[model samples]
Structure formats: C-alpha cells, structure tokens
Target: MKNNVKLARIKANLTQQQLADGVGITRQTISLIEKGKYNPSLKLCLQICYRVNAQLDEIFWISEEEFNSEENN
Candidate 1:
C-alpha cells in the first residue's frame, strides 16, 4: 500500500520517533510504514491518522495502478 505518512508527519512537524511515541509504535515501524514496506492494522492506521491530524484516506490512498497490480498479484 502507498501512503503519504512522511509528508503528513512533516506537515505536522513531528519526527519519526515522536510520531511513534504518540502512536505507541517504534520509530522503525513508522519508517517502514512511510516507505510502504509495512501495512498497519486498522487500529494502528486510525491511531496514526489521529496523531498526524489527517484522515485515513489522506494518509493512505490506493492509486488505480496499485489496485490493479494487487488484483493481478
């Protein structure tokens, strides 16, 4: 999945560690999520969105190409 987590974090003026602390996750996990290498659970996603002051869709949006690729896979 693709996400604008890093962008939102920057916009919110939060470092990875700060965001992780707010969401009760590790900095590595936040890094992984920002890189789209990790898929957070719904609860975690909600927590992150809240911390970043962004809606879920705004942070984690699926592009048409990604959706198609996932379907194919």
Candidate 2:
C-alpha cells in the first residue's frame, strides 16, 4: 500500500512522534507507514486519516496491481 503520510504530517506540522502518540502507535510504526515498509491495519489507517484530517483514499492507497497481488498473496 502507498500513503501520503509524510506529506500530510508535514502539512500539519506534526512530527512522526507526535502523530504516533496521537494515534497510539510507536514512532517507528509511523516511520514504517510513511516509508511504505508496513501496511497499517484498517483501524489504524482510519485513526491516521481522522487525526490528519485526510480522507482514507488521500492517505492510504493501493494500486490495482498491488490490490490484485495482495489478494493473490
């Protein structure tokens, strides 16, 4: 999955730690999400979207190919 977390956080003037704390996750988790190293659970994704004032699609996205591949996996 892809996410605009870094962009949104910067626009919101929130550090990774601040965002993580607000969403009850570790800063490392936030970093991984920003870098696309980890896929957040639906609940966490919702929390992030809400806290960052972005729509779910604006924050987290899966390309058609990726979606297909994930289904295969």
Candidate 3:
C-alpha cells in the first residue's frame, strides 16, 4: 500500500517522534510507514490518520498500479 504519511506529517507540523508518541508507536515504525515498508493495522491507521489530520483514504489509499500488481501477484 502507498501512503502520504510523511507529507501529511509535514503539513500537520509533526515530527516522526511526536506522531509516533501520539499514536503509541515507535519513530522507526512511523518511518517504515512513511517509506511504505510497513502496513499498519486498521486501528493503527486510524490512529495515524487522526494524529496527522488526514482521512484514511488520504493517507493510505492504494494506487491503481499497486492494485493491478496485487491482482497479478
């Protein structure tokens, strides 16, 4: 899944550590999420969305290419 987590965090004026603290995760987890290397649980996604002032779709929507790739896989 692709996400705009880093962009949202920047727009919300939050550091990775601060967002992680607010969402009860570690900074590295936030980094991983931003890098699209980690897929957060729905609960965690909600928490991050709330903290970053982004809607779920805004933060974690899958692109058409990714969706197609997943289907192929």
Candidate 4:
C-alpha cells in the first residue's frame, strides 16, 4: 500500500505526534504510516483523511500491480 500521509502532514503543519494525538494513535504508528511501513485500518484511514481534509483515494492508493496482486493474494 502507498499513501501520501507525509505530504498531508506537512501541508497541515502538524507533527507526527500531533497527528497521532488527533487520530487517537501512537506517534510511532503515525511515523510508520508516513513511512509506508504500516497499513492502517479502514476506520483509521477514514479518520486520517477527515483530519487532513483529503479524500480516501488521495491518501491511500493501490497501484495497478498492487491491486492485481491483492486480488490473487
């Protein structure tokens, strides 16, 4: 999975800890999400999108290959 979380965070002028606090998660979790090292749940994704004023597709995206692979996996 790929996300534009870092971009959104920067655009919002929010630190990872601030974003985490607003989204009710840990700073490490926000760091992981920003780094694309972790995939957040759909609910968490929604919360993040809401806080950042981004659409779900804008934040979390499945590339063509990834979409295909996911169906098979």
Best model number under TM-score: 1
- Write the number of the candidate with greater lDDT, choosing between 3 and 4: 3
The whole-model lDDT of each prediction reads 0.92, 0.88, 0.90, 0.87
The collision pairs in model 1 are none
Per-residue lDDT over 1-73 for candidate 3, one digit per residue giving the tens place of the 0 to 100 score: 5689999999999999999999988999999989877889999999999998889998888889887886676
Per-residue lDDT of 2 in model 1? 73
Per-residue CA lDDT of model 2 for 33-65, tens digit only, reads: 898789998999999988888898887776899
Where does candidate 4 have its weakest 10-residue lDDT segment?
A: 64-73
Q: Sorted on lDDT, highest at the top, how do the candidates line up?
A: 1, 3, 2, 4
TM-score each candidate. Answer: 0.89, 0.83, 0.87, 0.83
TM-score between model 4 and native: 0.83
Candidate 3: pairs in clash: none
Q: What TM value does model 1 have?
A: 0.89
Q: What is the TM-score of candidate 3?
A: 0.87
Q: Quote the lDDT for 31 in model 2.
A: 97
Model 1, range 17-38, lDDT digits (tens) per residue?
Answer: 9999999989999999998888
Candidate 3 minimal-lDDT segment of 10 residues: 64-73
